[model samples]
Target: MIIVTGATGALNGFTVEHLLQRIAPSDIGVSVRNPDRAQHLADQGVRVRQGSYDDPDALRHSFADAEQVLLVSSSDVTADVITQHRTAIDAAVEAGAQRILYTSALGTSFNSPYPPLAIHAATEQHLAESGVSWTALRNGFYGDLGDLLGPWQATGTIAKPADGPFSWIDRRDAGEAAAAILTNASSLDGPVNLTLPSPVTLTDFATHAAELSGHPVERIAVEDEEWIAGEVANGVPEAAARFTLTMFQATRSGHFAHPDPTLSRLLGRPPRTISDQLREQMVRTE
Candidate 1:
């Protein structure tokens, strides 16, 4: 049996839905923090079990009878993130899961300034020492480039501090590729970066947006402090604004710049691009 954790979340939920198309429902189980919110999955014939990274016993129970398990990294941004991931990995090992899959990030490093990178790095180390065969999907940054580029629907100006290239990707495509990996989990090993084949900078994206909208969208680069002040003036929370500002610094240092074809090879097609996503957004909001 194959078990998927965080199955109710947007990314993993889509992964489970796609997995259903490739595998039998009875062969799949969903381990979520709250089973009450997962009745819909159960109604679809998925075995729903309650589990949380905070509770190792629950994880053991949730992973019962599973040959392979997918460990979706925790969303917690605090120091507890690594501890939580370690707990889950230990539980998966204790539960006799022969193989494990993880949803890691593209620029994951032990020395990255991004807090999440540390969490991923630590989890990978623990997974390696656990003696369980594992695969890490180094997925790209999944954000609305249109929003970052211009908040384009409302503002025709792309405003931010100078940034570097990002191979922006669609989450749905990531989910589909992840399902494919799970289907053949045994053949793959170590880290596989699931990113676009092309990387685009914010300036290039703004140019494309202007051409698509037939409007003159301007790309404005401001000082980091000024950008934070502007975001705060627009009613963004101080902590959120600061965190977002640091992301640009990370970007400028070439964190999210690499592009890989692993995702396309898994899906048997090209992953959706920022332009494709923006065009769909425009059509939907029109």
Candidate 2:
């Protein structure tokens, strides 16, 4: 059986559908934090296992008789995710699962300064030490950028704590890559740097959205200290948020950057452009 965690999320949801397209429904297992909310997937013929990442024993029980386990990483910063992910890894090992597929961010290395990247890097190391055959899908910035930016940008302005170029890929496309790896049982033995072929700044995206939506855009220069202070004032709790914007500033300083067509190559298509993703946002929000 093929097992997938975080089954209700966009990445996991899309992966589940893609897996069905590539294999029989009976071959799929989906792990949800709550089984009650999994009716849609259960109706689609996925065997839904009720378990959260915190319950490693239950996670192991779920992994029982599973051949491949797709462990989707959590985006939480409480270090709770660290505990959860380690538990799942240990459970998979105990269950003797043949292989593991991990979802991680792009460009993670041993020396990453970004807190999220650092945690994922440590998780990658932990997985590597477990001795199971594994595939690490190092994904890029997701196309959800516009959702994060649009409301603020559309209010007579566009702004980011960011000041440099960034490449982004659609979440669905990344999901397609993950599904491809599992169904074909292909080992992309990676740190696969998944991303769009081109990078652009939030400033550039604002300018383009201005042209498309006819809303003139403006950049509000909040210094790293000021911006972070504002976020704290505005109730940004995770230390990751401050660290995230710092990475953006680092982008201006020429760190935390890569522009590879590895993801496009995997899917035999080009990654979504900023404009393409913006249009998608327009459709989604409307």
Top of the candidates by lDDT: 1
Estimate the Cα RMSD of every predicted model relative to the unseen true structure: 1.7, 2.4
Compose the digit string of candidate 2's lDDT tens values, residues 103-176.
Answer: 98876765654556777888898888889888788887774564347464457565457566666678888888
* Residue range with the least summed lDDT across 10 consecutive positions in model 2: 145-154
TM-score of each: 0.94, 0.89
Cα displacement (angstroms), candidate 2, residue 97, comes to 1.3
Model 2 residue pairs with clashes: none
Local accuracy of candidate 1 as per-residue lDDT tens digits, 1-286: 8899999888888899899999999999989999998999899888999999999999999999998899998986654888888888889889999888899998888877676777788888888888989888888888655447657657888888888877788889988988898897345888889998987777877787888899987888889899888888999988888888767777888998888889899889988877788788789778
RMSD of 2: 2.4
* Model 1, global lDDT: 0.85
Cα-based lDDT at residue 65, candidate 2: 76
Model 1, residue 75: distance off in Å is 1.4
**For model 1, how big is the CA root-mean-square deviation?**
1.7
